[model samples]
Target: MGKKQRRMEVFDARARYYPSAKLTLEELSYWIAFSRVMGIGPVRFQLLLDHFQEDVASAWHAPSYELTRIGLDQRTVDSFISQRANIDPAHELKRLDRLRIQVITWKDACYPPLLRKIDYAPPVLYACGQLTEDDLHYSIGIVGTRKMSSYGRQVTEHFTKELVKGKITIVSGLALGVDTVAHNTALDNGGRTIAVLACGLDTIYPPSNYHLAKHIVDSGQGVLLSSFPLGIKPEAGNFPARNHIISGLSLGILVTEAPPKSGALITANSALVQGREVYAVPSSIFSNSGAGVNKLIRDGAHPVTEVSDILEHLNIHTVPLPDTSVLREPENEEERLVLALLSREPRHIDDLIRDTELAPNIVTSTLTILELDGLVKQVGSMQYVRCT
Candidate 1:
């Protein structure tokens, strides 16, 4: 299909999903205009809304004195006035429409629920793909060092795959290393992911991930989310704010791997401040890549050894459909013993060994048999669960 046709379809889909009654298109244009002003952020934006009785168009046209009366400093008022003169609100909205981007304001019912609870959540979001209900509710933020070790890569893949199996959506920054692995694993497993960008959706930073970003949107399984306005470039200062959104959208933040100085720690910290759970993989004490996660665990972050650690703590219960074509009863006591220990919650092999008191070989062999009979499934590294 032609690019224009695809854009038209996306626009139509957005209209269907986000029909606005409280904020008309004209009012939204003013919101977009204010978002573009340099000095106005969520707090100031809210002040304007409250002072103007939620009429953003009125706020936009308010004189400098009125802006000052609403508590905007003289510098901010000057910036707003200077920018507002050059910014045509209608043209800004038209530009977004032309770019196939959808504007999600704080007033929209379709705004992410978790994000709305944050202290200073963005007043506006520019999204490039569909944001589903699943993305809003069942999301886990995966972040780690950009320079990942081989161990980091393996750990990220394992947790991501298991989370996807549990029907959880992955949220990440779309940076290299752990974020990339989490996004790709979720997609490969036929699950959804959300890529939160520091820059505007118009520009995919790190440029290398551009194709990955395209695939995410084109596959219809994920979204490209950003709070920055159109034409904004990726800046170093933008990342800390970007990290906040990643954690805000997720039920918890998981640090699969990271060094002590990794930016991923910033995200974990944000998760804590947001009153969200923080999960970290325990790595070797001697490994430099493990220092941040180890510190997190020491500071009371949940240490994840298996997928069940997250699922159980978060109270997320996922039951995969049984493979009807291969249903069979356990033919032996060993198979029955292993099957008895397995439930919808993933159990590590070591835990089963201790509980079953069976020989390691016996437990392994019995699990193999049960899996072949479609009675049990492995959700992660050496973690098994009942099929039903």
Candidate 2:
């Protein structure tokens, strides 16, 4: 079948399984806006839908106590109904459409089936990029601690680049530490990455990653997504709500480094609950950052010592994906530093940080780009061996 046909088939299947909306832009805008209401998680919201029976707008319009019966806490039901009138409050859909971001509802064919299967799937996703046929098949989630170690940072960067080289959609939360490294590494390597946010796409949470978030939207090749709407600041609770979507969209999640009780651990937990495989980069028992991963491994999560570990676990033959490291030409001083230290020989990242005088993430990122271009090969956990 043609790619479009295949994508449509996927969506059509979802439409069959999910509650139908008006399917109008206005209806979609309503769901998009309502998703922003604080305290309305996917499960509670789905319970309300059961009471209303596929009529989100009608259910949204129902009395506050009506939702309380369906599981929305009294306070949230009040807030949600109060917020319903503005569901498309800012004409954001027009702006989104103008910018080429596609909006996919739970009923849409393009929504990830794994994500849709989650108990509290967003009523509609305000997507900033297209989910093509190939996307349906080759999606992976790479996430972990925001304060990642140099080792965690490098493995996350390397494996994501390898996946991107294979034309996979890299999914992440766009948080500062590892998510930023993962998204940025994917981009630098000429690979597209999706950033799932805890807040609305209209605003960036960390603010530092704003430019990176913009880069994804501007590429028209990937998405910046959220269940929340415009004007909402990110809150702590909204974050785990955000984690589900990240794990929901992928075949599995890779925990590069996560301390006990870390948010990345929350994502890993979500992956487990969602029936997706979870992988961890085993860290030294001495480091606090590695504690969660060690615990996860002890609890039976697979350990990812190499890229092949993930690829093999997913059963994807990684040999065919295009090499983008060549197509991704580096610019200016940063590029110069990276190119200078990178050689065909296998080099540990510590030696590169010393030799190139670059931050570990930067050197790791640069090597990722070169590797994606088919220019470097990572031979060991710490080594970057240039491909040519």
Candidate 3:
């Protein structure tokens, strides 16, 4: 028998055994196969599912005429036919099993409920770590420029720590800069996080974050998520599609810092379209990095200066804190000097050196000591600021 005939036969045999909401192994394989198709995205895939009576396996093996009738153009139908002819659903599942990547269909109970409410919610997600009930309860999508300023870093870390303390699950695109800081700060605070990737779960895009990805998976504190199947590379076009999932999965989106027309802006727009709240941290008007954020604030995004702003907007009560709001007295002359030089605004090491007339080594060591004592935080590039 032909491969299409074989697929139909298998579908027929399992037709009586199909569950109401969950995908069978064979069904999941077809879902994975559908994810690999270029022209068939969330909306087209949904059309196929509905046309096939929600049997994705049957839809996967649907003939060209049926696909064209379901609104796929000739070119797209041709591509889908050619791609389907080459992929093996069973072998794809085996590859996923080998990589330890887990697949969840839209019908799965564990799928993000908020994501399901979106118009083009991903039909399937490939994840590298555990996704639990709590992750869905309260999630904040944090996004910003890959070229983050020290001030952006400081703000991201501060708010991320506070969110974790409030038991909010942090979500981000797993890009560089703000995304990395958000994930690390959440993990550091012993809270859960979820990283939605622009590529497949098998490949960590940006490569530098491979160790961080592994830590998230192995530590069970976060999940690495993607809508693409295995072996998909992080192409430029993939990220705009990826941004939808980030916003779709979150309760709201926080744009820490972005330049005009940045990818983070795309995510914020997506959040607004999805009816999720968009929050922006107001930044110095002089900084280019803050331009997008300031515009967002002007556009009526909730302006957040502190974590309480976010918590208040979300109506989540903060956990009680110990009484340690006051800054500690400096232990020595060097510590006193470092404290005197630092302020709420982030200052780079070179600036400290220029102002203090102290050796760079002394400045660096003092900043490190101050950071360890929770009196200071290193934002990036040897920049330091007082921890509020």
Best by TM-score: 3
The digit string of per-residue lDDT tens for model 1 on 1-388 reads 1111111123222332256778888988898898888889989999998999998899999999989987999999998899899999999888888777888988888899999999999999988778888888889999999887656776887788878887889999999889998999899989899999988777777777877888888888888889998777777899999999999999999999999999999999999999999999998899998899999999999999888889788887653421234457778888878888888667899999998899999999888878877677776788887864
What TM-score does candidate 1 reach? Answer: 0.80
* Whole-model lDDT values for every prediction: 0.85, 0.72, 0.82
Runs off by more than 4 Å, candidate 1:
1-17, 318-388
167-276: candidate 3 lDDT, tens digit per residue: 88899987889999999999999988999987777677777777777777778798888998877778888898899999999989999999997899999999999999
Better of 1 and 3 by lDDT: 1
lDDT (0-100) at residue 250 of candidate 1?
96
lDDT of 2 by residue, 289-332 (tens): 88999999999899876666777778887545544334444666
- What is the total number of backbone clashes in candidate 1? 0
RMSD of each: 8.0, 9.9, 7.4
Rank order (by TM-score, best first): 3, 1, 2
Q: Which ten residues in a row have the lowest lDDT in candidate 3?
A: 5-14
Indicate the residue-level lDDT of 20 in model 1: 70
- TM-score against native, each model: 0.80, 0.71, 0.86
